[model samples]
Target: MTATALTMLNCHLTIPALYFRGINDMYVRHSRIQHGVGQGSFHSATVEFSATGRHRFDYVFDCGALKYAKLSPEFQYALKRVSLTKRAPGGNKAVLDLMVLSHFDADHMNGAQSLVKRYAVDRIVLPYLGVEELALIIASQADAIDKDTLKELHGLANGVGKLWKRPVTMVKTGPRKTEERVFSDDPQREPPDAERSEPPRTQEFPHPVSVVLESTGAAPGTVMLDEDNLVVGSSSAGRHDTWKLRFWNRGLHATLGEPGIWQDFERHYKRELPQTQTVVVPHHGAAPNAGARFYNPGLNHRPRVNAVISYAVRNSHGHPHPSVLADIAYAGGRLLRVTDDTRLGYQEIYLFRP
Candidate 1:
């Protein structure tokens, strides 16, 4: 082995080094908080992780608004930026790893149909509703929103209708407890004909990504979401980091004025609230949805929370209520209002492993 032979070996070694760059650091590249029009909501985040190899998981929470006939600008822009498939090999149809539709409000999900058409979503997460709850949602908003949106809501209540092309997780809340159940629209997955003896068809992306609920003392478990359990902290794992997101959605029947929702939320963490880097203000910062419990950083110290309020400039509901704004300020949260206007631009938050 001479000097030339050694130099040739080093050149080959550097080729593999290019592929392993940043392979150890698992972090969120950035989250795009969409400035939706007329009280819509769209927030997406890209997480880079290493499993067998480096991979990226993209997820979106709520994409739509109260646009009458046409799709909103922000939602359109979001679609433009979102990739058509998962950021890995095989070229699967699934675009997002997870899609969370908080509730059935028109403003929050008016463009859902468009989303379904544009991207093949992997799994959708929404609150589970009974007949009464579904009826309340339809009857309550019958006159306020368009009929198409109402029809779509009706479809989701029954079985996610056209959107049923993908998998779904329905989160049901009980007395101070929450349960999640998985439902599949694909007959191969959950065959409609139970009597059939044939095996299910093979899936391009067979294994779906799961939300792991974590607690202080307990190790997180991958949720099949088919059992009775209380999942407080939902997290997605990277190679060296685990990112957590806590969603607080007061059920349609829950009283908004009081703090029961917050109480139930806190109880999950054993009364010790963890440090939340970002908090999406619920209901576009509607007054009823805002409570002091949401702002508390608790014993675990944290930097300024990013309080994101997605609403329109002149919304009929007057969202981002003065009190909600004030409460966020008092809690030392960095108020980041996301409206239809481009003034605030895309509020991108970068997350790194602690």
Candidate 2:
């Protein structure tokens, strides 16, 4: 938590977990992983951020702190709700650390728009080039953005003007090796609520206690399990302060061939550490994010990755291609989908300060 400790971490180390509200949803499943990883260190303070009043496609990402920020309908609703919760004292939810736009598609941008309009974001992160550059999102004749959207873009553009000084990258790195310890917990539903005088409002982050720490500190695959520790609610895993990944859609050959693309994320990661824990899968787990040739894990030393997509089940453009899923398995990473728990609203989490 000091400047010295901060120097040892990866950039991705601090994103508490995030989830989404699935309407016409595809399997983005990001929340599921966060739900799993979060365990019990931080309360997954999440809400249905999307409102019927907003535009259809946009989804936003906010930490109630300013590491990085973006706008979208889903995000806008989340912030409106988060603002009401009175965020934890100093979680950096307000600091503009990084920014990302999956694609230039209006729905995606709508969420970006909302973030730009609301927060003092420092950077903007996006795939190598958004669909707008491909002449698909802004100029697509079949699904061109409408007047209302254009107006939102105008506001977003104006907002972005102030962020010229902030760093933007396709890959983000954050604090270093996080230490983990287990805590007490219960299985199934209903955790014994910690005795807080008031209902948790805003992100009840920086949890005070309740760990189930125990390590044989021995050989591999041989460790004891604490019955009191709820794996779902335990804060035992350690995280590197810093992390790294390449953000591109599909084929590694194409990605590797495109040196400029890697330059962005690489430069960004090197700005701090050598690697990252999570890399936003470039194309929402699509073929473009993978390659025909096998990916060499030894050579790659890939980070803990999970695909983050905001598509619904019946979306015209199918998501989470079979190949992408295989790639994650090959890479030993997890596939997180937003649609996995539409019934749960938005899945939320908090990254601990190691």
Candidate 3:
């Protein structure tokens, strides 16, 4: 694609269909997850599903850094970079389709308010927590944050709309049957997957495309089926050729008392974990907060799972804990961290259609 053609596509024009046959194609060509570099924790990625080379879903999993100053420039750059291949239609501003606040930790969510104010975010997802749990997370950061910043955080804790005018989805932990729905419009029925005009041929994308994108803390109801694709092997009525991306969040407080939490998250997504090929290690790779089970090699289909860690060098907490490193090594997983190179300040993983 020429630079002009790419620019026109990024602007959401319909000119691509004239030159490319994959304009309406349903299968996911590949997905590239870019981990942003900052002193603290920040993660966001642009998923490209169109064979014609366009990003369909732009999402930010978490945003915040140990140093507040770095958050603005780094996050802005990330936001702009992801928006290059796509922008929400009928809008002058770049659109961020999804924003998931993993937890209320300052390092994980401090940049959200600014982001919401600057960009056009279609939906926001966060773990459902009681007033007490919200208080606990806020209090943990009170000593370090300013009163105004604290107030803004508190506003977000109270209700997402209180701070920003975007819709919010709360994911909670409970029996799989009682999970709350987020991505789907119908609460009772499963969200529709990407549109499939016909069954996928065996020759498409090869066999057993690994990498089950599973989000802990999210219940089965939170599973979002994109309108342009279907699960690779899900028995749903459609061609089983596209990759499945499900979001499940496990609501764990930032404090270190929840060892059994991972188990609950694991059980909630037990049906989908086996196909997992990449794991976005939580809590900046803190063992106590996320545990070693995140790197379970026996269950993950791939020989070497992609273990992505987002943390900064010389951080106060010494993130990407030694234990987490050991867990990845033991599982024979590949460790990719944003801090691996200071100059780039970003790490990426590309998964192509077989």
- TM-score per candidate, chains pooled: 0.64, 0.39, 0.63
Compared with the true structure, all predictions reach lDDT values of 0.47, 0.29, 0.45
Ranking of models by lDDT: 1, 3, 2
What ranking of all candidate models by TM-score puts the best one first? 1, 3, 2
lDDT digits (tens) for residues 1-354 of candidate 1: 000000000000000000011224333343454554556776565555433233455667666766554456766776676653543322554466666676666666667667766666766666665567678876765665566655655676676553446555565543443432222212123211321232322242222233333222132222212122222111222212333333333456443334664455445333124433455565667664443322232311244756667777876676767876776776677777777775333456454432
Residue 205, candidate 3: C-alpha displacement in angstroms: 26
Q: Which one wins on lDDT?
A: 1
Error of 2 at 25 (Å): 43
Give lDDT tens digits, candidate 2, residues 49-68: 21122111112232221112
Query: Residue 222 lDDT in model 2?
Result: 12
* TM-score head-to-head 1 vs 2, winner: 1
Task: Compose the digit string of candidate 3's lDDT tens values, residues 76-98.
Answer: 55544454222434156566766
Worst 10 residues of 3 by lDDT: 4-13
Off by over 4 Å in 1: 1-32, 68-70, 84-94, 143-162, 174-250, 255-257, 269-272, 288-303, 343-345
Candidate 1 clashing pairs?
Answer: none
The segments of candidate 3 whose C-alpha lies over 4 angstroms from its true place after superposition are 1-25, 49-55, 68-80, 85-90, 143-162, 176-245, 254-259, 288-302, 343-354
